[model samples]
Target: MPDPHSSDAEPRPAHSAPSSLLSRIKALLRPAPPADREGIRAVLEAAHDHSILDGESYAMISGALEVADKTVADIMVSRSRMDLLDVSLSLTEQMRTIIETGHSRFPVYEGDRDNIIGVLLAKDLLLTLSDHALDIRALIRPPVFIPESKRLNELLHQFRISRNHLAIVIDEHGGICGLVTMEDVLEQIVGDIEDEFDDEDEKTIFRTGDNSWRAMGTTEIEDFNDVFHVQLPDEDYDTLNGWLAAELGHIPRRGEHFQSQGLTFTVVGADGKRARWLHVQRVSGASSSPETHTP
Candidate 1:
């Protein structure tokens, strides 16, 4: 009989490229039995030999496996970052405001952000604008309520089937919490998303100019270190807000001024007790300054 250990034992095509991914996958599947430490090593080695999988495919499989474990809280835009329509206004006012904000989809609320009634499409507003006062009640679409722990992939499918872009994410107590958009869901599949509504100029944290810097309050203390290249060591804070709070020892009111590490923080606009907005600038070299006053 012909030698069984000869070339006949290798049944694979001789012309196959050494880098052929299918050939490597076949190699990976060829292992037998207990698959102990050594066998596991072979699986990894075989995987390395093949380009059978790509980054996108790996992300998809990983996402599917971990999706249920992922929460809407993980993917939902924070309330501070949300662009929602305060539906307490008249329809005309709402439409005008939405136009100014440049957001096509908006969450509509009756009295407060916590009482979201439904979502309104910009197209619907245009249709109703012919009348003096567009009827917001009539233009409202049914709100899709999602828990903060809902899986993103499931929500994406829901968005497709229902043709809804905005979903109101609710907390366990049924309070209106955050908002998630179809774009937010898509960003999960891809990476960070840049859309028309997002201002390119506002993308960076601290933007410097002639004697002014517009910074997002959420910019990290470490980033503050990097941008100004300074070491302001306040042990208790990681955000400008935290720094301001620590300096003030209380929630700062509008027009309050505090100084630390050669920088001055002025509370520009505040909602009640919390500092909703701030103006930050390097303290000009001068004599001692008076307490800040608001206009």
Candidate 2:
């Protein structure tokens, strides 16, 4: 055996990694089940704090618990932003909108946006090109209308049973309010769900509209500042998502917006635990001057 003080000896780890996480959890809850949700969450949190549970596992578990309390209105895409396909439009017009949105599916409307007729899959359009006699209406699948007040847990159950991926949301007066997707519900439990719109490369931000941009939450604050020519404080946070959470006093959620230094920060993509993407736009006549924030 080598001498205990030998400099050439490989240093042993101060301690071995903790035992299997399941065993740790079982030990923590050996006597009985937690009396309530709060009690169960407290135990989970304690384990998380002690490093027995990793951050991703902790976040997902917490998110699953939270979904039961959230409503459709909490995360649905608002009416004004929905990409509705107008049935009256010519094939060219419909194709233009669909390509621009880059969505796999859209809600079909008859006359008004509120009068949603059905759902249309982008892939369904390929047949239209080949069959000149096909009616556009024939391509639509029945639209599912859900009330904005509907609970997310119930909605998720319905989605699974029906195998429908999208639903139109309506207000109490039966007017269109927004839309929801299966991906949206799943996101609450599994973090960001990558889609056709998401770029996995070094391109962290993309121009969405005139003077508006979409950026990943993980984009470096420095990169964002350089792209937009504005100074957002990078002293405290490495990513824009971190700063937004601190600014909002919690993990940023979808559809939440805040105005700061003449720019609007709207969280467009987020799960239950963190912002995945954000839409940032410069307010009209707003100057991109050097700015400072106290928090």
Candidate 3:
């Protein structure tokens, strides 16, 4: 009989495999357990509870998962709020608008916002000032247009491949509805990303008295609740302004006051449509309610 372990033994057929190979084949024969969203969420929550992941990390993971179901329409800057430049305006005038907005880029339009021709990068305009003869149009980059319904994940991928920072969101009728930026998409994943323009010492909610506080319209509902030690419903809205809007059935204008959840929200500063700053005060001896609101 030949020694099976000996190299000198007759060579086995090509199809015959070693014992270690057979073990790997056995391992491959077993299928992995199927995983669903709920299972993944549970795992994440467990990790969070064990402190394997921080709260911010958990929130960002959840946001990343949530973004897959969101579209450009959800977080886009509405047309009314967009800072635009008219191509018909003189370079000096356009520079003034750019400086006032403190924006690095602006959509250039021929006649109106609807007639957007291209994007004008602020840095590109500097070169024009140095060389007065340079055509402003030559510096304009072709605008990227995306459908309002396009999923954010797909948009992010397009942004990566195209190297574009902003895209004009178009409605079904082929009209510009709003604009979305790379920052907007990333904000969803990593929470708010403040720029240099943001006030470093600005407080979202400032205590003015024993029970009175001045809060920014953009202050997150959770932060507001933590600061006031109140249980405010946050399921329907994220910001104080959004909650006020939902309560009032419309965006509250300046000088408007809405009472809800044992708190009185007074719009102290606002533009035509959205509230900018609000004065909040707790109603003495009043019980909190989830749905009760008075205008």
Query: Against the true structure, what is each candidate's TM-score?
Result: 0.50, 0.63, 0.59
RMSD of each: 11.2, 15.2, 10.3
- Rate residue 294 of model 1 by lDDT: 31
TM-score head-to-head 1 vs 3, winner: 3
Best by lDDT: 2
Better of 1 and 2 by TM-score: 2
Better of 1 and 2 by lDDT: 2
Candidate 3: C-alpha lDDT: 0.79
By TM-score, rank the candidates, best first.
Answer: 2, 3, 1
Error of 3 at 26 (Å): 16
lDDT of 2 by residue, 25-129 (tens): 889888777998898899899999999999999999988888888999998988876778888877776765665445788999987778899999888887568
User: What are the per-residue Cα lDDT tens digits for candidate 1 across 148-239?
Assistant: 88887788888899988888888889887778888766655564454443353544343334554544445567777787666755477877
Q: How badly does each model clash, as a count of residue pairs? A: 0, 0, 0
Global lDDT scores for all candidate models: 0.64, 0.82, 0.79
**Candidate 3: tens digits of C-alpha lDDT, residues 1-295:** 8779988988767755687699898899975443877777888898899999999999999888878989999988777667788887778667655653456778888877799899988888775686655557888899999999999999999999999999999999999988889988998899776543445266677665677776778888898888878776799889888888877888876556777678888775554456767778888877676445444
